[model samples]
Target chain A: MTVTDNPRSYHYSDNFLDFTDEPARSRITKFEPGNAAREQTILRKLGINGWGRWQYFRTCFSDQWGESKQRPLSPRSQDRFFEALEKLRIPKDSKASVFLTDEGNLELVWLDDADEQVQIEFGPKDFEVYIEGSGIDDQYSYDRLDEIIDRFFAG
Target chain B: MSVSGTEDIARAICSDKWDAETGILSASLFKGAETSVSRLSITPLEDTWTVFRKNVEKPPERLLDRIGIINVQSLMDIGSNFEANPTRLSVEPDPLDGYPSHAIIPQKISRGLANKILKSLDIREEVK
Candidate 1:
């Protein structure tokens, strides 16, 4: 079912709550040697490294680690991972915000403000959702995200 | 010059053979002649030559006119069709695939610059 259709089935767990409360700090702690070592091992297994760190972390945390009920994880633990990411103190000029929906979708909101706002949604189920506030094309939305981030960070 | 010679001069200026006295010809003449040219020649006519020079000169005005003439209903149709049948434009691999890069920001220095701007404008508080 869609996110809106079955919201109750996706109740927020303690892990999700804890991570969301202080995402930046929580993500940093999770990325450390001890807690996310399994995540690192999984990243290695997936042949991901460097810039792929966070993405790989998300994938592993979702598909493998989250799904393994026998372990100390659930099938939607990536929601917690993303919640943690949202709290992280990115550069103030960094207009990117990550959010985890009840339905386990990870949303990346960028270029959000009065003039224009763009949202890129992805999840373990390959759900891709994009919304643009200014009625611009999705390509424009994607390009705007790239432009804002590039212009800000590239300085 | 004869009317045909004047027309030929118009065609030459239109074909960009000789620069016109006013730098470009009138829009009415340009548009009418432009439609008569062969389809294969249209690309060079449109790109290399200033076929839409007048339109380009006042792009904002032209854009506003386009919006006005097309109306919101047609625009909605176009947008819906585009959303339903999006085209794949490129297939290039990402350049910073292996680096510890932020996809949104270009590099650390740009990030710093953005931070400075944000701090100056007090936008950092909103983000925090």
Candidate 2:
């Protein structure tokens, strides 16, 4: 129940999800404070402003769910966020595209220069690694579909 | 019908240079669309505060309704924690109950990747 002021604090919440099923390795690089500043700067550079456009919302998790965290933007926010993101710099020859799943979760796909795929889920309250190396986890993927519309409206 | 227009308006607002006049324009445009416009403006703090209060009073009710559930849960959890260890609690009841309950740790995009992306965006000049 500690409230953190830094946007990077959200990164820990990202790690919490990344490590939810399997504990994240200590070596799994943690984002430095400066990186968060960079992200804020990037957001600023991309001109993300005001509510419902690349905005962050509070999310409450039941005790059964471990640590609670705020969710990223809703589908609309996701759309606007990524649209702004499209204006951002990504790796060379890598393509980035975001999709809102039928269930309302956001799937961000980053294709490496070699065309390898990395997929991540951006849900109402957390972000999780959904797939890597071209495999899908349908169970975890659709488990929270009903909540998508809810999060979209909430954002 | 107005949804797409609103979306366009949002895009315009996002991409616009953040100046006092643009802020005023944003406030007016957003207000016309029935969205909260106070935050979109760069007016004097007092004027902005007044607008913010009025603007948010009846927010996108649909949006507020959804966020309200999350807020309620957070408040209840905070209340429970206080009951369990009131001595450890320091802050007063949150005025904005919707505030996130946990700390956020920032994550950095890989430097190599950031450089690549920056180059691709053609805004490397802005990336000092």
Candidate 3:
């Protein structure tokens, strides 16, 4: 079954169920390392599809490493990116990759079969988006999580 | 041989700069400061792929396993705003010991231009 047809069943086949009704915005206000509740809240929302990318984010954060300088991943940017991922689940068939930028921000890139691409660099106060496909190649700046979902993620 | 726009340049790609499953390279491989021009090190192929791959090394933790190849003309021909706009970016030799083919792109690279550049690359893995 397609993801939209039976999301719960599809998620269950992967043995990952996101059990939360809380808004992603509320949980991303801050990132506390030892805060289990906060971590679970976001992790569960990721389900199976995003678990690996989330792990990479955690790895980059803890690594505190780069070639030129000690450019560790930004905690606030990580929180914002986590919030974005919570809202926009990567489809099982599609691929999404995360990267640590030189400016200490997190970039999430999503690509699908139709050649649709959405790339967002999560910053402390805002995020930048690049959407390309079907003759549309444009960039936009957004601050709210819901608007990003509604504008880009919504079908 | 000297570096030229007609020749291709190669750069070491760490594990983080590319995705094995998707076979897609991250534009983060080209990110730099937003203000002043920053230097990105690359090696001109100069008809010696084996030697270039052997000499460009990285730490064990950051394995130099993948090499991304793109023509220098591609960077010089980077498009902007979905159009062909003139860019001020430039590339030149900045050789160091044991790396005579070393070159550098001395400019502030935007994510858009980086994306375009990576899209034009031929990435090979297990270089070393």
Candidate 4:
């Protein structure tokens, strides 16, 4: 049967009954690492040595340990990230690469971080942030910086 | 294929149509509604096929734009969006792969400079 026909049955059949009613936004806000060691293992598994592309080598440079992109990690951004790290539930294992977006200066891509597969896109330079994935695609423009940080990052 | 064989496949894609219920882009290779053995395929795995497939989808007239509806377009778009603009990636193989070394080119590498980098890395551009 089509998914819309009987979502309950479909969920039971696909074993997606585990899917939570809690929103992807809640998942991002409530995320917290089990421990530092657990997060380190994930970085190691995902290969921590990402480098810049040969063609666009300069702008997309990365240290791979944590930083990704030519620009050094912003002190404010890093501090915010550390604060988020206390709450964000990083996935156990996945192909997701947490990197910085280059659209308008380096932005945080807390991309695909949770079990719900939520991807958040944020930019301080251009004053824009958005959250997407798990079938959700919404935007938070330059005006909503404080709201985004308080809702999604601040615990 | 010969001139006529190529023409037959094009006709099938238009008249006979495609079987895109599956993600694959397959059009009958022969003229008639003959056996399904004769078919041409386009998959997203091959890097260059997209350039041609994209060309096919450019004509905005078709009511049923097979290429547009198929999920492969999104796959290619997302992949291109990500890989075409990546923060970091390295081709240097690990120690197990004989300690492959990569050169750090200058800030702005010329066409010739890029060629030299590839040559130094022993990576010949695939002769298409």
TM-score of each: 0.21, 0.21, 0.68, 0.26
Clashing pairs in 3: none
lDDT of 4 by residue, B1-128 (tens): 11122211111121012222212111111111111111123222233223323332222221122222112222223323442232121111111122111111112222122212222221111234
Q: In candidate 3, how many Å is residue A3 off?
A: 61
Query: What's the CA error at residue B58 for candidate 4, in Å?
Result: 33
Per residue, candidate 2 scores C-alpha lDDT tens digits across A1-155 of 45665534444554354543321222232343443553564344433332222222212110111012222224333433333333434454454443323223444445545555444445444444422343432222334444532332122
Q: Per-residue lDDT for B112 in model 2?
A: 23
- In model 1, the Cα lDDT at residue A143 comes to 24
Error of 2 at A31 (Å): 29
**For residue B78, what is the lDDT in candidate 4?**
31
> lDDT tens digits, residues B1-128, model 1?
11111111101112111112212111111111111111112223223123323322221211111100111222223323444442211111112322111011111211112112222221000111
Off by over 4 Å in 4: A1-76, A103-117, A125-134, A141-155, B1-128
DockQ of each two-chain model:
0.01, 0.02, 0.15, 0.01
lDDT of 1 by residue, A10-75 (tens): 567655644444442243324433336645533433223222434433443332121012111122
Per-residue alpha-carbon lDDT of candidate 4 for residues A1-155, written as tens digits (9 for 90 to 100): 68688756533455333445543212122233432553454344333421111112122232221101223223334334333333444443433333332221222233244533333433332233333333333445545555655775454
Order of candidates by lDDT, top first? Answer: 3, 2, 4, 1
lDDT of 1 at A131: 31
Residues B32-55, candidate 2: write the lDDT tens digits.
111211111223333333333332
> C-alpha displacement of A134 in model 1, angstroms?
5.3
User: How would the candidate models be sorted by TM-score, starting from the highest?
Assistant: 3, 4, 2, 1
Residue A23 C-alpha lDDT in model 1: 44
Please tell me which predicted candidate would have the highest TM-score against the true structure: 3
Q: lDDT values of the candidates?
A: 0.27, 0.28, 0.58, 0.28
